[model samples]
Target chain A: MIRPLAGMARVGLRFQLAYRSDVIMSVVALVAQVFLLRMIWTALYGGREHDPQGLTLEALLAYLSLANLQAFATTPIIPRIAHFRIRTGMVFFDLSRPTGYLPQMAAFQAGHTAGGLLMLAPAVPVVLLVGTITPTEHPIGYAATLALGYVISVMMSLLICVIGFWTLETAAISMLYRLVSHFFAGTMVPLSFFPGALGVLADALPFKYMGYVPAAVYVGHLSGGQIGQAVAVEVGWIAALAALLWAMWRRAHRRVVIQGG
Target chain B: MAEVVRTLRLYWRLQRAAMRGALQYRLNLVIGVATGVAYQGSGFAFVWVVMHTFPAIGGWSLREIAFLYGLRLTAHALYVLPFSSLIGLDWLVREGELDRVLLRPLNPLVQIMAKRLGVGQLGDLLAGLVLLVVALPPLGPASALFCLAAVVGGALVETAVSLALASLSLRTWNTIAVRVFADDLFSKFGSYPMSVFGGAAQWALTFVLPVAFVAYVPASVLLDRTGELNVPAPVAYASPLLGVALFALAYRIWSRQLRHYQSTGT
Candidate 1:
């Protein structure tokens, strides 16, 4: 099982690497985003060392750097793949595969993500040039939380992909999700910066676990006990999203419609 | 003159048919428009939060910044509404669809543009118009006319940029990434007062990318903040003409590049 999945993953990785222009452009976009965010935050700080919320200019820049990198690395390719497969009637092949369709898709996505990690090499220097990451004492905690965040992120993406079963046109839905998640997930702005009822709303959503929690952990924004609590919350959301996705996939499988076959 | 009018009429008919075809997927259309609105709205909301936290950026108040954002978005909508179809040129060229386009009787550029009407941009138009009306200060008749011209000019400037980039696809290169990056540069940098970015970056955005011409220069004129402009007042006032000139140049590039087109043998 592992060997077949590994082969699928390799195919996915090769598919990503074949798009040389896309990889270069993604690095360019990442650099530009990090630079722009750094500039904006610096200007916002107005030469002050720190803000009222205890977020220093250095810390904010570091958070933004990681957040943007995280965003670039985990951009939801699976949803797009699912949409394309459904629209072109190629999803039939996946359905007929001996391996579980979900696991195959997950393996492929994992491979694609590994390709994104490879592209990160070119971007790391650009990130360092803009800002320095605050050294965290709890590297183990950060890594564990980030792994959980990755799981939650994948589950969220798979859920969005499942929507393709119902509507072949998932472009708008995927775009809307990107925009919403980019903001609420704390890729664009830290949840700490969100004010009043908006902050409360962001906290309520699962998107925060995908971006904010791990980034916060990395920057040492969350205390020791808070990290434990955050990890617990991430685990809870992952289980919930998994169960929901399973139910939806079962229903979607029952009445699958191939569009252009 | 008569030939130009005939071409225009044909283009309009083609565009209308394309729009009708697009309307077949009503749910997708609705969601697309909503997505457009949500996208721009969230962007503005981010600025709003920032402004609330910090009093002002580069001496521009929230109202002034909002005006700048509105102008850029309105211009973006104007460009995207008609020319969004050009974004598919990379695919069209790769798949040999351009062969059919070349075989058509009408102008290839017009036919390419008529392939689709960007319905989602209507949402951008709505959002931008609201911001413009809300954030705009009282003005004389001439100033108001100037504002309208600026919006059109901004749209033209953006169109020229995209058209120039899309022309690269004629050489059989995938230009999607570069095109999207350019779009991002416009929306990201064009929203704020250029002064915040300091001298070097501001100059690059102006002379290099011409993002400054899209909204910053004209908005400065409208808001009576021209004193802080990097360029002379006349250059700012002539932004609309610059857009027209740039677009003509881009069209020339497109025509030249089209001569080099070779179809992918299927």
Candidate 2:
């Protein structure tokens, strides 16, 4: 089992390595986004008290810089995988293979994610030097939270992708997903700044688990109690989503109907 | 002169047909519009959150920011509605679909632009106007005129910038790359107030990208914040010039591509 998973990981790395051009595109996007956002937040907090929720402008910029770096890292490859499966009738074909479907999916995703993290190598140095930063108070703890957040996000994202199998029309769902990610993840603006009812609502959802929570934690927004609570909720949500995904995939396999070519 | 008229007339007919096709799925269209509203509507919510945090950005208060938001949203609607069709022209060009468009009596560039109207964009238009109504503060007559002119100018700039970016795919082999870059460029910067950007970045938006013409400059005029830009007051008032020049240039460049079009039939 471990060997197959490692093999799959190797396959993902090789595939990602071959995608030289696409990787370049994403790296350019990451840099442009970080720099541009730095400018916006600079204006947002310039000469003013950016002390809302204890947010220093420099910390917020660093948070955003890391947010952009992690944006694509948490994707559920299951959507594209689902697209190919449906188009090729491979969901049933996969059932014939000698492996647990759920683990198979997880292994493949982990492989892809590992490759993506490897690609993030370029960002580390940039963040160290060029990227705006808050003084690192709990660098190791922050890394742990970020790592856990990536895991939770990947699970939830895949859970959403699995919905593609059940719902033929994913356009609206996709739009909602993209839009939610943009705003809730602190990609648009930090959650600390959100207005009354919506702000409270934004806090409860797993949306912040994608970017904001990790960022907030990195910059010391969540205290020890608050961090514990958030991480607990995130882990609970991840488990719930993973279970739901497994059940749905099994049901979907039974209902699979292939049309004539 | 005649060419412009004919081009406009053809695209108008194509738009009507496109609208009818879209209208066939009335429920879907309604849902699509609802989705679009929800999609953009959340930004206001997020902006509201930010206001609560800091009260104002770059000296613009929450209410004033809302006004800017409306202007920006409306500009985006205008950008999407009439010229959303221009977004896919690069795909047509890359696929050699232009050959068929060229064979017709009408100019291929115009025909290609005329084809594939996405009426779903009107949802964006309606949402924009609705936002404008909700966001605009009570203003005097002069500011009102300025706001109106800004909306018009913003729309023109957005369309021109979008189409110009689309035209780049004609000469460049990377159509999707250019297309994605165009959408991201306009949508990202256009949402925020210009003051949010630094001096060099602001200049790029004003002179280079001109995305700020989508809402920032003219709205600033109405809001009485001309000090934002180091440029003279006239430059802010003349925001429409970039849009006009760019739109005309896009079509010209697209036309020039017709001379070298190697249709896929080959």
Candidate 3:
């Protein structure tokens, strides 16, 4: 399984590299978003030590930049693949393949993510030179939490994609998901920055574990124990979402087989 | 002149047919519209959160920033309602659909655009209109007229930008990334007053992309909120003219690309 997945990852990497312009365009868009967010936060900082939130200007800027970087670097491709497969009735072909559909998808995404990191390589220098990259007191805890957070992110995307089995207007489902996730994931704004009530709502949602917790962990916002708790919570979400996706995939596969579509 | 009028009439007929087809999917239409409103509302809500937390952003008050946001959204929806279908050029080109479009008697651009009206964007238009109406106190007649003209101008600039980038799909074989990038740029930047950005970025938005003319300059001139910037008084007041000029340039680019469009079969 590991060897085949590694091969699939290599294929995904090559495929991503072949689309040089897409990669370049994504990087360009990432830079533009970072610049736009940087300007807005700088303006909000208003040359003060910090707003009422107690975040130093540098700290806030650092958080904003890193959050965006993380998002761009780890953009989920499985949803897109699943979307295409379901839309074009290509899942029928996948079902007949020797490998398990879920593992194939996971391998493809792991590979694509590796390729996407190349696009983000240029931005790393920019973030380091200009951004406030907060290092956590507990590097090991941060790494573990970050990895777990990524698993939860992937599972969430898979669930959204698998939902296409039920709806012809899958784009709508994906768009709605994008809207909700971007808000709750702290891609648009840090979860900490949400108003008191909205902050509570964001915390309740699993989306924050996708982008916010990892960055928070890096920024020392989460203590060592809190990092452990965050990872545990993320693990719980991963298992729950994985189960949901499994049940969904089973029903969808049965439908495809029975309908012969 | 007669030819242009005739073309416009045909386009209107095509649009009406598309609308009837869209009406069949009533639920989808509702969802689309609601999604549009929700997306635009989120941006406004983000601004609200920011302004409520901090007194002002770049010296623009909440109401003033809301005005900018509302104008951009309204203009964006107006442009999208007619031309959003053009964003699908990548799919059309890839599927060899453009060959069929090229064989048609009508102008290819017009035919492509006339296939669908973004009825979903009506929600954005309504939301933006409500926000603008609420944000502005009763304006003088002249100011109101200017605001109306600005909305038209801004919409034209936006549609022109989409068309210009989409036209490149003929050569690039994929223009979706560019379209997405442009949308990201406009939505992220358009919500705020341009003066907040650094000098170079502000200049890029003004001259290179001309997005400032879409929302900021028009809002500034109409609201009498022009501040310490190097934008000349006359040029800032000529936003409508600027929009027209930018659109003309984009159309020229599209026209040039059309001539370069060789089918994959060819």
TM-score of chain A of each: 0.96, 0.88, 0.90
The order of the candidates by lDDT, greatest first, is 1, 3, 2
How do the residues A9-71 of candidate 1 rate in per-residue lDDT, one tens digit apiece? 998788789986878887887788887877777777884544757777787788888888887
| Worst 10-residue lDDT window, candidate 2 chain A | A252-261
Residues B1-266, candidate 1: write the lDDT tens digits.
98799899999999889889889988778887888889899999988877777878777889988999999999999999999899999999988899999998889999999998887888899899999999998989999998999999999999999999999999988789989999989988898888877789999999999999999999999998889999999988888888999999999999999999999964
Instruction: Report the C-alpha displacement of residue B266, candidate 3, in angstroms.
Output: 4.1
- Model 3 chain B lDDT-worst window of ten: B221-230
DockQ of 3: 0.56
Candidate 2, A1-261: lDDT as tens digits: 777666666766676667766666676666767777777667667767536567777777777876666666665555566556655666665556677555666667777777777887876667544456656666755666677777776676566556656664455666677677767777757777776777798887777877887777777766577777776787787788778877887786666654325
In Å, candidate 2's interface RMSD is: 2.4
Clashing pairs in 2: A193-B49, A193-B50, A194-B49, A195-B49
lDDT of 2 by residue, B1-266 (tens): 99889878987898787778888988778778887787677767656666665656777887777777788878777767666666676667667776677678876555655565555566666767877887787789977877777777777777766665666666645666656665677766776777677778778877787777777777777778888765688987877565666667766766676565564553
Pairs of residues at least 3 apart in sequence or in different chains that clash in candidate 1: none
Off by over 4 Å in 1: A47-50, B260-266
- Candidate number of the best lDDT: 1
| Model 2 bad stretches (over 4 Å) | A3-20, A47-50, A87-90, A127-130, A223-226, B1-6, B25-28, B139-146, B264-266
Q: Rank the candidates by TM-score, best first.
A: 1, 3, 2
